[model samples]
Every structure is written in C-alpha cells, then in structure tokens.
Target: MKVLVKLIFLLTMTTPAFAQADFKTEQLKFDRVSAAYEEKWNSLQEALRSAGIGRPFKLYMAAYKAEGKLELWLKTNGQKTHQLFRTYNFCAQSGILGPKVKEGDLQTPEGYYYLNVFNPKSSFHLSLGISYPNQVDRFRSGKEKPGGEIYIHGNCVTVGCIPLTDDKIREVYVLAVEAKNAGQDQIPVHIFPFKMTAGNLNTYLKQFPAHRAFWTNLQTGYAYFEKNHMIPVLSEKSGRYLFK
Candidate 1:
C-alpha cells in the first residue's frame, strides 16, 4: 500500500514537469518574434485590404538595394496567422535599405530570399529576420562573409536590414503576425524600384538619370506582374529575360 502511494506521488510530481518541459520545447521550436516595424506592417494590411488584397492569402517582402537600383524579395504563405509579425527589408545597409556582404561592403542583396524567425527585441524596434547567403550567395561569394541579420525592424538605422522605425514596425508586425496565424507558410514578396506606373516610371527616369539600366530591369518585372496580377518569376537565359 505504501509503495502504491509513493508511485502515485512520483507520477503526479513528474507528469507536470514533463508536460511543462514539452511545452517549453514546443515554444522554442518556433519563437514568437517581435517587431517594431509596426507602422509598415499596418500599412501593408491597410494597403492590401484597402486595395482589395485581404485574408486567406500569403505575404511578399521586397527590398531595394542601396543604390535604389536593385531589389530583393521574399514570399511567405499564411503569414497572417501569426499572433505577432513584421516585414523585413532584405537589402538595407545604411541610411536606406539595400544589400550587404563583406565587412564594410554596404550593399543589401538583390534577389530572392526567405525568412527564418521573428525577432521581437531587435536592435532596431521589432525585426523580421531574413535568410541571406542562399545558394546563389554561397556559389558567388565562396569563402566571403555570407551576410548577416537582415531584418524588417523598428529603430530605422540599418547596417544591412530594412528599418521601418519603432512606430512603423509596431503597425507592420501586428498585421504580419495576424497573417501568419491565418495559416500561411509561404508568402510572396516583390520588390521594385518605384511604383512602376507610367507616371512613376517617368518620374524615376527624369529624377535619377544614373539608374536607367537598373530601373529598366525593374520595370520589366513590374510589367509582368501588372499584366498577370500575380507575382511573376524573373530569370535570364542566354541573355534573354524570362518572365513567368
């Protein structure tokens, strides 16, 4: 009878601990990241909903390279489902957002990328981190520094991540989290030089004469999407642009 009682006590004591440990592990499996990029996130939701792109969809993150010429993108589905979230600028190095690689090389990447986590307590407000140094990066840089900590965050100053400032991050983060929680795992993001309308194109051409080649490529991508109303893939084969 005493052994039976002791067994029961041990089981009761250990069960709660085991359960708690499991819960902690699960929580760590996918950390609920923070973002100060709230304003930008909110702007995205408002823009999408107001522009008629709402729930039951995915997310896309686009970042312009420092020169304001090139850009990078990320696609995430069901990002609205997360209870917390934010968008990141894949190519941000200094005062603006852009790509970066080697030390002191302040150029944010321009191409396709992915997200790894949500960082709440970011050096800049709230941040959504991006996965840089993908296949292309590895192949190209070889033994070079494969970039680091690219994010969409608050606090606004970036060495390589997109910064929306704390106020802005808060707005964007909330909407992104909601999007994730809605069951999206892969979101699609398209980055362009400008709005890519006739007027905007003209403005860009007139305003920045040095960026003709860069803007031209950006317009091609934008046009593909404009015609299809969907994110189009861009590639070059035998020196010819391929859009699908």
Candidate 2:
C-alpha cells in the first residue's frame, strides 16, 4: 500500500499535465493578443524581415524622456551585435527629469531595468511592467517607500510611467511576447534622461547639477552599448551602477 502511494505521487509530480497547464496560460495570452492584432503582427514580421532581423530575435529597449521616444533594438540568433528595429513615440509625459524617489513623487524612473511582467488584459489596453525601485532606487528612497508599479503601457496618460497609444502598445506587447517565447529572457530596458550625447549631457548638467553624477554613471552603460551594439552587464555598488 505504501509503495502504491509513492508511485502515484511520483506520477503526479512528473506528468506532462502540470507543464501543459503553465504553457496553456502563456498560449492563451498570445492568442487573445493575436486575435486583436493579426494584421499588425503580419506587418511586424514583414518589417523585421525588411530590416534583416528574424523572428524570436533578442530585444533591447531604450527610452529617452527628453526626446519622448522609445527605441527597440534587436539581434538575430547567433549574431554578436544588435540593430535598430523601431522607435515608438510617447503619447504622454509626466513629472520632470529625475528618478522616482517616493510613492507619490510623480517622477518617471531613470536607470537600467527589465520587463518583469505582462498584463494581457490591462485596463490601459496592454502593459509591460518595468522593474523599477531597483537596487539603486531602494537604497536611495529608503525602506519606508520607494514606489512601485512602473510600466511602459498604453492609454495616452501617465502620472509616473511611460505611456503609448493603444494601437502602438499592441505592437510593443506582441514583440515582447514573441521574444519571451523565443527564449530571450531578461529583456533589458534602459531609460535615459536624453540621448546622452556630449552636448545634451553638458546642457543637462548645467540645469541639474544634483543629477550630474548619477547621469554620468548611466552614460557609461549608454556609451558601452552605443560603441558595441551590445548591452553591458551591470552591477550596483554603494548605490552606483557599475558597468562591466
């Protein structure tokens, strides 16, 4: 009787049914989004091919607050470098140029982050959550409140998040899902105050001296990618970003 009980437990734990249940959840999300975006999905594929990028390619995103643009970068499998894929404009903006420090500060965060969640049935149409209040933010904002729930979402409105139009977000969301399905995990999302050009940096420094050091550190990662077309491995030490 004990042997039979153990055998049944092993079977239940190792069966494919458990795995299929998780897969079905992801598939359902894809199907719902695909149903609403069949045409856009087709066009995205064509655009990818035209740009010489293939499906399931790794994706990197960079958002510039001053420019109000989100640039998508892609690299095909086995490639050593990424290429510019598309740029989406922000439909709305909020707060001023700075990192979000508190829960109600109304400031969009500025730093390196990743897409940590997907909202298929978002009230904003569809949303990609950004991993904000990251290591640096936590250290700077303290334990009491560092804010949360930052996202690159749709709805054309924002208090402390990046917003895109409903139609535009569908394209972004689809690309994110396809990349995840393709096994490119940890999609990097870098948010910058501006393009990080020499002139822009100098001007920003003049206007916001307090942020100069932080922005300077961010520029290191920015320059590394600009020169190599590859995302650098980043680490935090003493609340500062150390790019490897």
Compared with the true structure, model 2 gives a TM-score of 0.88
lDDT of 2 by residue, 1-244 (tens): 9999999999998776555345324745665476646747788888998999976689999999999999999999889899999999999999898788889888899999999988877778789999997899898887759889999998998988889888888889888877776666688999999999888999988989999889999999999999999999999878899877
lDDT of 1 by residue, 58-114 (tens): 555554443332222223343322211233343334532222345446545544555
Best by TM-score: 2
Quote the positional error of residue 93 for candidate 1 in Å.
Answer: 5.6
CA deviation > 4 Å runs, candidate 1:
1-54, 65-99, 190-222, 233-244
Residue 22 accuracy (lDDT) in model 2: 52
Model 1 weakest lDDT span, ten residues long: 78-87
Cα error, candidate 1, residue 32 (Å): 11
Q: What is the clash count for each candidate, in the order shown?
A: 61, 0
